[model samples]
Target: MDNITNEEKQQSIEAFQSVIRKSENALASMKSGSAQSRLLEKRLKAARIGEGLLAARWEGKELDVSHDELVEAKQVLEGLLLMLPGFLEKTKPGSGQRTYIERRIKAFQMAVSYLNE
Candidate 1:
């Protein structure tokens, strides 16, 4: 339990991409080119910053970040969450998607805690 396994890293990447895809679909139904939609795109990019550390695993290559790296990456993601607008937090894309993001944030927090231990 000292570090996250490669499988865990891959799972995290998959989960991240899953949400991104869901967000994309959700965004698409809105105006083709709207402010909130654009902001969601930008937020997705910011959220995916940690995926770089796990890209090799996601791609089936020979690489993955260490426990400390995972912790740092999680911190980056948490920071990104903090920077999101209050409207996005309350009711822009609606409840389900927002809850998903909130759950993902919690999941990341738990993963970081586990990796740290």
Candidate 2:
């Protein structure tokens, strides 16, 4: 982070925003009880994992946990980083995407805050 150029950081931030918006829209537009609902559910889970990864990057100091907890967090973060690209490309975006994604992000923050305690 210290060595990252300003331009690079800005680019990363913009990419992060794009990923978030695309993933959220896709996750939210998915219809419940559809044949592919289960798959959509999985994609939502992966996006939440990505949200956690980004949050940890920007808020690492506030996220104190045990070594085992840290390990679990790292695994989730890595999984999100790996899965996000394919998931984003595969899922079609819709109007309702942001609502569900935002709800999940709030829930995720609550869950992780408990781990910190």
Candidate 3:
């Protein structure tokens, strides 16, 4: 594989920073009871699980064998991605919370794409 260029590395770093900012903002914005808030929580959980799986794969930890398991993971990720647009559309911008949720959802979508590849 070709080495990542300096510009590419910088972009990657910036993207990661953006995701962190977004997550922080989303957490701050969450309320105790609201549909949007609930959806955001659910999406965040899904993203975390996806991140865990990806991290495990990167660390060369072999997951237990099962065709059904792989299929379920993919299906769930896809379903979460599909739910993003609706959640994003409904969320209001208060204290920059919506922006953060949007960023996280986008990040999760990108992760799903990477996994598919």
Candidate 4:
């Protein structure tokens, strides 16, 4: 994503919007206290952050994220980092899923570092 062209970033922003809408719809259908709803909420938040990141990039500027939002994103991503290793271990070595998980881990680490800064 760091190397994506402007056109690609625009597409990513659109994709993130779609995810946010769908996640919102799904969240509406779930029980308020259900684990699924909680997970969906997190997904929605992540999509929003991703979209904002892309939008800022498109505008040729740094993201103007709020302190609280950055903290929330960092917490969510750190939680995901804790869980991803289990899934990564289950995938076969050299598999596409494995590679994807690896990349995702790296991306999350980078995001956490950026947020910290």
Candidate 5:
């Protein structure tokens, strides 16, 4: 398999950061604001942190991951999805931002599902 270049890794990190920012912004916009927003925000923060750790691992700065870290990251992504309904309902369905968030949610769900298998 071909190894990912530094530029590719950086781009992946930036994309993940953009998803985190969008999620945060969406949560902040919800008027019905529930505890779920807080939960999702916390999970998204953890996911971003996990992405950083993964980047370090990719860079050979980390030794290895234990079973627990992998599990925690999976759980964080799941938590983010669990909070999505509230935010999704608030978004106008056809708006570009809403569409982007929906796509991100779908992508995140697919990743979590793949990790679980």
Candidate 6:
């Protein structure tokens, strides 16, 4: 894994914080056990994972997965990226849910990039 500058790490942490807050607010309004709620929960989990990964990388302890595992993860995230637009379309424009989806897309893209590197 490439070493990230401190400036980049700080910016990423801040971005993750914003995404987490939005996701939490959106999830609070969603009915528990519903499909939408479940999906948002997954996205929230991803965001937390991404944040932890960033921190680990910054500490010079990047993930020790095999190259094959990284490639597989990147492929999975790519597939999700292709499907997210349909999910985004189901939400109202300018709504908190839509914003959360957008943030999720961004988080997934960031993960893909990290895996690619």
lDDT string for model 5 (1-117, tens) is: 125566655555565677778778888786545787876676666556555654665665752556676677778877777887778888997997676567556556544654565
Mind giving the per-residue lDDT tens digits that candidate 3 earns over 1-117? 124455543443344455445665787777856887665555455445555544444456854535554555556657866876887787786746576556556545555665565
Model 5 residue 43 CA deviation in Å: 3.3
The local lDDT score (0 to 100) that residue 59 gets in candidate 6 is 72
| Candidate with more favorable, higher TM-score: 1 or 2 | 1
User: What lDDT score goes with residue 88 in model 2?
Assistant: 43
Number of clashes in model 2? Answer: 1
Candidate 2 has its poorest 10 consecutive residues by lDDT at 102-111
Q: Over the stretch 10-108, how does candidate 1's per-residue lDDT look in tens digits?
A: 566666777667777877787866898876765555445444534643455643546555555566566655654453466546577675555465445
Candidate 6 Cα lDDT to native:
0.71
Model 5: runs farther than 4 Å from truth? 1-15, 20-64
lDDT per model, in order? 0.56, 0.48, 0.56, 0.71, 0.64, 0.71
* Cα TM-score per model: 0.47, 0.39, 0.46, 0.64, 0.52, 0.57
Residue 91 error, candidate 3, Å: 2.3
Off by over 4 Å in 6: 1-3, 61-110
Candidate 3 has a TM-score of: 0.46
Worst 10 residues of 6 by lDDT: 1-10
| Distance from true location, Cα of 61 in model 6, Å | 4.7
Stronger candidate by TM-score (3 vs 6): 6
For model 1, what is the alpha-carbon lDDT of residue 108?
52
lDDT of 2 by residue, 1-117 (tens): 335455544444444455557756775677867766665555445444434544565555443445664556544434544544554455456635443344343334433443344
TM-score of 1: 0.47
In terms of TM-score, which candidate is strongest? Answer: 4
- Record all residue pairs in model 5 with backbone atoms less than 3 Å apart, i.e. clashing: none
